[model samples]
Target: IKRLLVEVQHVKNMKEKERKRKVEEKKDNRRWIETQREREKLEKIKGINTKKYRKTKKDIERKRKKHTKEEIEKTELERRWNKEKKSEIKKQSDRNK
Candidate 1:
């Protein structure tokens, strides 16, 4: 039946969304852990380290944090885009009916 097929597809979509949510959460947790580790490294660089070494470490940490933040932003944007596309498709289908 068309209705049954629609229900099955909806279930699949829900499952996929749940999976994506879990993956996004994992990425966020990873970003948090990396940020914490970077901060800890920066703190540790405060004592008995050469000024040059400290500067280099700080720069690397800054770049890494920036990279991770950008990646998270990108993922969120893609998710939003996909959500909008699905909504648009649903609207079009309704209009067709």
Candidate 2:
């Protein structure tokens, strides 16, 4: 009878050890998955931020080019008008003479 009791106790101890090992393995797997998710989220945010910065920079460059073009055209028109006015004055003076 004592021999039978000893055998039963040994079997119970083995079962308890196996259960503890399985619980530890499950906890490790869950922690790894959580860390992986956080890393992916940070990378996505970084990519979006970079794209917005590039688009804003391009828009500023386009605006500067348009302003420069308008200024150049206005100066050209003023120079042409001045030349025409000078020629007209000379012609009038010659006719009066």
lDDT of 1 at 78: 100
**In model 2, which runs have C-alpha deviations exceeding 4 angstroms?**
48-97
Question: Could you give candidate 1's per-residue lDDT for residues 2-85 as a string of tens digits?
Answer: 999999999999999999999999999999999988876786766547676779779989999999999999999999999999
Clashing pairs in 1: none
Residue lDDT tens for model 2, 1-97? 9999999999999999999999999999999999977766775657445565567768888999999999999999999999999999999999999
In model 1, where do residues sit more than 4 Å from their true spots?
47-97
Deviation in angstroms for 92 in model 1? 99
Give the CA lDDT, 0 to 100, for residue 49 in model 1.
71
Worst ten-residue run, lDDT, model 1?
Answer: 43-52
User: How does each model score on lDDT?
Assistant: 0.92, 0.86
